[model samples]
Target chain A: MREAVAVFRKQILDTRKNRAVLIQFIMFPIMTIVMNSAIKVDDMPEFFYLKLFSIMYMAMAPIVSMSSIISEEKEKGTLRALMMSNVRPASYLAGVGVYDFQCCLIGTMLMSKTCGLDDGPWWRYLCVIMLGLVISIVLGASIGVLAKDQMAATSLAVPVMCLFTFLPMMAQFNDTIAKVAKFFYTQQLYLALEDINNVKIGTEGLIIIAANAIVILAFFVLAFRKEGLTNE
Target chain B: MISVTGISKSFGDKKVLDGVSFSVEDGEIFGLLGPSGAGKTTLIRVLTGQLKFEEGSAMINGKEVRKLTGADKKKFGVMMDDFGLYERLTCYQNLKVFADIYGVGDEEIATVLREVKLEDAVKKEAKKLSKGMKERLRLARALLAKPKVLFLDEPTSGLDPQTSSEIHEIIRKRKDAGTIIFLTTHNMTEAEKLCDHLVLLNEGKIVERGVPKELCLRYDHQKRIELVTTNGETISLQMDRENAKKTSSQIAEFLKEGKLSTIHSKEPNLETVFMELTGRKLEV
Candidate 1:
């Protein structure tokens, strides 16, 4: 546990030291919130823009942070050194994942406030954010782990974020597409943010989130094991 | 104490380690001497528990290194050829993190930093430091654990002579403190000076094993005698001791007759011994 904390603390310290990362952590959410609110929608339903902003923030946060963790470490070869240490692979990933999740949650809260959302039942939103953050972080980390370098990480992450973020945007054209979108984990958080009346979260959403979490955790374990076995 | 017996590793069909076997006694400085592509690094990795061998077992302190848990791994310190460093971290932070991982106190961090002569640049981020400083910092982290066994792969590969000597000094001190050290290097001089016992590896096999002096004596049986004549002509002779003794008398007579100049005997060094064993040079 102490070793995990040390790894966490080191990652946090490293994150804090990077100026661009700091700006991305703070400024990007604020910009997204402000830019979404500035555009006037004609006869749009209530909470539509709020839901859109929340989805964008959710997708962006994990994509940026998780990919950065993997690609940057690979680029710098810090992962190799960390693997050589006494810390277990699981503990190291947990520490790094926890920090990534926390940053995303904080960024979500800041985005919520900046967009002038009603902030009704903030606790429920926080709960959803926590759960959704886990799913997104794991998925993003999987992508990061599989990517060879930063360029590959970014190129891969952008499309994934877009696929999840724009899922709801496709709902207007077809009801079936909206139903498919609801099966996406990010869509569940979007539903919570939209807070549409009589809308229920089906088993598919929960199963998708849980299944993805398990698979991603498995990937992380596999990646770490391979690294431990092969790396000098 | 570390023991590796009949260890073999292959990446697909290309065998990297072909049944290599060696042992390092407790508190002894054991050198793995080989040229590049001789499986030196692969053997080091296996001994350090970073790589697995298909055919043999490595026991460190009576426990199989391949089966070491997290706590057991803490008792080892390894420095690979890659010199992995957290580029964004300061020299101090890098050492501190490893110290913390190994459960060493903060005071030990400072002690190790000082030991590696990295005290002055402790605050500098690793990426900003020079290559020599980075290498030193890597060494410092390896030492911070106060490990029972230290594994160093090409530790002084890229350093200048002075920096290399400084690093060697620390290794000597650690060895003196009763730490079992497994050092792999192409520097024959370093192997000669630092190792109490050594194995010269070729294609993942132990081609030779002994102390430096022992191997030199074994391979270089006939010593050469160089004689310079009074007329400015140099003569070289190689023979057994009895023949050398007779040659020495003749050379003395030649000197008395004003026909001989400088004379010296040639004993084999580590480099000559290596060439005799593998028919190749330690090119690095």
Candidate 2:
């Protein structure tokens, strides 16, 4: 636990100084706030802009930011230094994931506030979003563990990022894409968000989100088992 | 203590380390010298359990290298070719990461920084420090845990002479404190200055291993005397007993004229030993 916190502390300072990563975290929240208020259209779905930007923030921030942070650590050899210090891979990953997870939750809260969903038990709503965010965090960390360096990490993360971020946003316009995106955690989470407004999260939506979380976590464990042991 | 026996490693069909073996005892500075691509770094990686080996066994502090747990690794400090540092963090922050890892207090961080003469740069971001200072910070990180064994891969690979000398002094202090230092370097002068024993690695195999001077002597097949003339000319002579009488006349001419600035047996250094054995320069 102490080691995990140490890595967390290290990563917090590192992330603060990294402008590229910092921009990723702030851009989404700023966009959600600025755009949601600016686009005052008539007859729009009650929380359409809030929900759209929240999806963008959740899908992109955690995965891209986490993967890039990890890959930067690998590229600069900070990961090796951490490993040499006898830092367990799980603790290191957890530390990194926790930072991204917390940041994304803040974004989620902002979205919830912008949507005025806080009158009820907002913490429970946040918990539901937290569950979905785990999939992104773990998937990002898995890509990070597998990538050799930042460029390779970016190369590998871009497609996965697009698949998760765009597929759902695009699914709104295309029947075929919607058929496929519904199964994705981001899509299912969006469905859950819509249900949050309706005050009734669908059982099937939660099930798909939970299933996606399990598979992403499973991939994280596999990636660590296969490559984490090597000091490379 | 560290020991390895018949260790071998390969990637795909290409072998990188073939039947490599060596041992390092407490207070010993064991240098692994080789030219680029000679598996020196691979040996360090294998010993550190960073890279797996295909054959043989290795142990550090009585624990198997591969079986070493995270707790077991606390006894070791390693600085590799990468010199991994959090460039965005200050020197103090960088050391704080390991200090936290070892469950050490801030005092230890202060001590290591002072030891490496980096206290002045404690607040300086690592990326802003000069190369020599960055190297010092890296050394300070390795020393933060006060580890029993240290694996330094080319610690002075690209430093000015003064900085390199300072690092050598730090390494010597560690040796005096009974740290078993496993160093890999292409600098023959560094090997001779700091290594108690070293091995010449070439093409994934050890070509020579011994005390620096002894290995140099072992390969010093050219038995000759070197002369420096008053006119600033150098002369090399075969120094066999058969030619001693004639050479004495020559030796006396320079000695009598007081131009024999320096004279000694023309012994080979580690570079010559490396060349004679592998036919490759230590750093080409």
Candidate 3:
């Protein structure tokens, strides 16, 4: 546990020094706020701009951040150093995970404020937000483990970013997209958020979310088991 | 002490290490000399417990390598290539992380940085350091634990003479302190100068093993004697009995007539022996 704290502290300091990550954390939420004020229509959903950008942020922030940083560590051989210090794999993950999950929570808050969510009850928002963060982070971690470097991690993540971020946004209008997007966990997260005011999040929606989380978690474990930290 | 008995490892169908065996006692440097792909790095990995072998046994500090725990690993200091540095962290921050891992105080970080001559770059990020400085930082990180066994994989591959000498000085200090140092390099001069016992590994096999000069002398089968006369002329003769007998009176007359200015017996260096055994030069 002390080792885990040491790792976590190092990661937080590293992220603080990393300009690119700081930018990613703030960029989308700021963009969401700008878009919310600029684009307004009568028939549109209650918080269309907030919803669209928040889901996009969910896909982009945790997934890209975890994958890129973890893969970069592997690429640079820094992970090997940590392992040499006899830091357990779990401790390494926890250290990085705590900071990464904090990023997700903070990102959600920023995006939530784009609408009037800052004043509303936030418990339900957090419940689904936690689920979304887990799936994306695990999926991202698996990609990180599978990739040999940052470039490879980005290559592997681009399509995932597109499918998860854009598909649900398009599904808001098209019936065909809506039918297909319902199966995606990110889309289910959007629905859960949309109905949070009325507590109308469905059992079927919850099942899809849990199932995707399980599948991505399995991939993460498999990748980690196949490649422990870094390959020589 | 470190010990290994017939360790073997393979990736897929390709064998990276095959039936390798050696042991090192305290206060000695064991050098594994090989060209690229000679399984030097693989052997280091197996001994360090970063890699596991399919056969044989390895023990370090009286603990089985395969069964080593995180606490057991605290006694090892490894400086592998550039893979062990955090590029964005300053030299101090980099060492601080390891210091915290080793449960040492922050003062030790300053001490190690000073040891590597990197104290001046305490606030400089690792990526901004010169290659020699980066290597020094890596060394500082490895030495944080004051380890009993040090594994240096090509610690000085490319550097100026001054920096390399400084590193050699530090390594000598560690050896004098009774740390068992395992070094792998294609640099023949380094192995000869630093290693007490040298093993020549080629294609995952030990081709030769002994003290540096002894290995050279053992392979000096075609010994030759060359002489320079006072007339500035040079002549060569084999040390074989037949050749020595043929040239004895001629060499005696030259010596009596005061023509012998200089004489040298040519013995093979480690490079020649490595080439003779492995059929290739050390790759720079």
Q: Which candidate's TM-score is highest?
A: 2
Give all TM-scores, in the order shown: 0.89, 0.94, 0.92
Per-residue lDDT tens digits for candidate 3, residues B212-243, read 98999999998888889998999987888877
Error of 1 at A55 (Å): 1.6
In model 1, which runs have C-alpha deviations exceeding 4 angstroms?
Answer: A19-24, A36-50, A74-76, A116-120, A170-180, A196-204, A207-232, B226-235, B250-264
Q: Sorted by DockQ, highest first, which candidate order results?
A: 2, 3, 1
Model 1 pairs whose backbones collide: B228-B261, B230-B259, B230-B260
Off by over 4 Å in 3: A37-45, A118-120, A195-200, B225-265
* lDDT digits (tens) for residues A124-153 of candidate 3: 777677778878878888888889988999
Q: Per-residue lDDT tens digits of candidate 2, residues B1-284?
A: 88999999998998999999888888999999999999999898889877889999998988999898888788888887585788899999999988988999999999999999998998999999998999999899889888999999999988999999999999999999999999999999999999999999999998889999988777777778788776878899888888989998988888877888777789888888888887889996
> What interface RMSD do all candidates show, one decimal each?
1.8, 1.1, 1.3
Cα lDDT of model 1 by residue, B1-284, tens digit: 78888889998898988887777898899999988998998887777666778898789999997888767777778887564687788988887777777778879999999999988997999889988888898898888888898989889997898999999999999999999989999889889988999988877788889998788878767777778787878787876766867886787689678876677766687778778877888764
Question: What is each model's TM-score for chain A?
Answer: 0.80, 0.92, 0.92
**Against the true structure, candidate 3 has what lDDT?**
0.86
Model 2 alpha-carbon miss at residue A106, Å = 1.8
In order, candidate lDDTs are 0.77, 0.85, 0.86
Q: What DockQ, between 0 and 1, does each candidate earn?
A: 0.58, 0.76, 0.67
Maximum-DockQ candidate: 2
